[model samples]
Target: MGGQVPSKLTEKFDPHRLVMRGTQAYQPRCIALEGSVGVTTRCSIHPQRPSICREVLPSWESGEPYPQCDKARIAHGLSPLAPEDWIRFKDANASAA
Candidate 1:
């Protein structure tokens, strides 16, 4: 099978999981400019930072500020969307044994 090659840019863009912390413990959510926890220097996932990072302006669209990336969905009054939801949806149509 022939397909286009994936560039380094493609490998560094993940839309799914957000990278919270690397191997370090007790890292602050917001970091200093020059310290080890700085935004430009000590990011947990420096390479794969998502595009949505810039679009997260606090209270721009509403009075509530933009929450952390992990809780983005829940902040919008939606559930975490667990896989169990799909299982339950499937079981609704399942025949009795």
Candidate 2:
């Protein structure tokens, strides 16, 4: 078996460069994405989510600003997460070095 990893680029990818399902493509909310957009949200089929859902991680999770997170938030009239939004998760001694 070839032990080579597949390239991330190919046709059937969006401008954000994510592979989207036919119905979810260009649609703000995905069939897999459940719950309210602004108030609360969760992936119903997280274990079997599409490539787009897997690729587009939350900003705090990847430690980089993910525009999809912000876009979704704004679309539902919710503010984008602030840099300090994840402060609660910080270690107590992280800044005491």
**Candidates' TM-scores?**
0.21, 0.55
TM-score of candidate 2 to 2 decimals? 0.55
Query: What does candidate 1 score in Cα RMSD to the true structure?
Result: 17.4
Q: What are the RMSD figures for all models against the true structure? A: 17.4, 8.1
User: Which tens-of-lDDT digit does each residue in 1-97 have in candidate 2?
Assistant: 2212133322245665543333435654454556776667786656656554567667665467889988867877888776676775465447765
Q: What would the per-residue lDDT of candidate 1 be over residues 1-97, giving only the tens digit for each residue?
A: 2122223223322675333232123533432113432112343333344444445543323334445632654644554445454566458758542
Best lDDT among the predictions, by candidate number: 2
For model 1, which pairs clash?
none
Q: After superposition, how far is residue 23 of candidate 1 from its true place, in Å?
A: 37
- Which 10 residues in a row give candidate 1 its minimum summed lDDT? 1-10
